[model samples]
Target: MSAARDWLFADIGGTHVRLCRWGRENGAGDIVRMRADASAGVADALLGFERAQTQPAAHAALAIALPVRRGPLRMTNRDWILDPESLRATLRLRTLCVVNDFVAAAAGVPVLGERDSLVLREGVPGPGSRLLIGPGTGLGVAALIGTTGGDERVLASEAGHMGLAWQGAEIDALHGLGRTRWGRLSWERLLSGEGLGWLHAWRSGAATPAPAPEVASRAAQGERAAREATQWFSRLLGAFAGDLCLAFGADAGVWLTGGVLDGLAETFDAAAFLEAFDDKGRYAATQREVPVRRVLAGDLAFRGLARIVDGACRAPMLRLSAATTHRHRN
Candidate 1:
């Protein structure tokens, strides 16, 4: 019996797209092809894959940060809107699983292991489930739900847009940010990339530039005002972490991910961050019980999508046809 079949996967972020193929090499573990671009909807990035002489795979999976209801999926933080059925037809994959990005990320947690994680607390996470929240081009949230069917599901969240948590000085800052464009503060008001820039501007009492890249660059170069902006950014992240821990009863801790966290790693001290997180009035001890970890594994969501497609990347196929060629090596 032959044990080889090809599978496809991709991770589409707000700023870029990555696509890859995976299959067994020598009848053992699965391996992946070099990642290719399925760029942000400008042109079809799968043209080469379509033209390949080899017959295509029977299954594929796409992990996107957009809602996948049935028809149209407009991304929360970007201009790309994808038609899942249309994409599946174009790819000609018999089984193309569409999943939420945060769900995908949460699914891969089991395989991600320790090396891919960074510890920010030391206590037990308790009976509460794990929560994942990330602030970047947009904010992402998910809950790792244990199912009654003896399986697990990652529930996607719109909590980022829920509402801004205002307290003490944060209220004034959010009010100022809200007035810049709107009349009231929303969670995205102080939790997204653009929001970070606004916070930096308000804290520095200076006018923010057109693009956000400038704000980061100025901070990295040691401008006192810019540094304070970055510091405030870290402070808010800590506060939000505390809120998530409380909301989910996630004594199991919470995770932080995405590109923005990647760059701000150095600016924020995890210990100091935890201190602010625990400063949550009456919930102080509960806050201390939860920990925070940064999800640095970039391919987390990609690998998770692969699992949803099959138990493992190259697990026994669920859909097979006569044309399902099993290429054998001598």
Candidate 2:
């Protein structure tokens, strides 16, 4: 259990897979990205990386955007299924840790420096807990339970599928449009990149939908409808953040992550977000005191992985259901 031990790290998402190797003394090696092709399994991908390294890693720390509780952990956004036993045997590792991506993101909080995040609200965090919410290929939620001696425990959740609640007439109208296609609307349906595009379509009544980045770019160019939709998206995101704060009792603070929020950095209405975020009637004062910030560290999760491997953070041990089933794609 030395800091100089060789270890492999991965952050798997729906569209991309990030891989890097950490050495004993120098910290993380060069980070690399590869497409998360359903046709190629993660085992094969890791092997390719190992081939380039001087030696195979003794342990691996992986974070994925899916539920790893109970039975087989099926990816929410992709068809790939992962079994820890299969991976351990195939990669020839002594240990493997698979955590919810948000959990890893949450783990990175204590270690985050001022240069790693942009502060949106400057409030003194209470000792309760910290909340994290982000929308990328999907929405992710996690809580960091505060403890004595400043140690925190991470709790991962699949809150994206939770029913979207009403914020105002605008959210109601947006729901009406979304439900027509998705049947029951969830926050992720309207808060993610794809959701942003859908929001633009619903607002403009345009049959052809555009990607979220394009919508943001167009909005920057004075596209009225795109601008309006982006505003609505921010408002809804604020409302959701407020609701999560109440649910989790996270009086400490909240951190916004993911590429969607990052892409909207230039055009996002920070004031509007704060307005909706603190709009809770009775709890407005409480919500107002909760800090909100955006993570600036792109490698936070991997850093968290390093912490896990270094035993600096106490992440949940990877568990396998008694009935664990393995699926291979070749």
Global lDDT of each candidate: 0.64, 0.80
**What ranges in model 2 sit over 4 Å off?**
1-5, 147-151, 319-330
lDDT score, candidate 1, position 170: 51
> What's the lDDT for residue 195 in model 1?
70
What are the per-residue Cα lDDT tens digits for candidate 2 across 143-225?
A: 87866234657777788889888645755766676668778899888888898898888778888678989988888888888
lDDT of prediction 2: 0.80
lDDT of 1: 0.64
Give the lDDT of residue 244 in candidate 2.
90
TM-score of 2: 0.91
lDDT of 1 by residue, 52-71 (tens): 52656556666677755655
Clash list (residue pairs), candidate 1: 125-251, 125-252
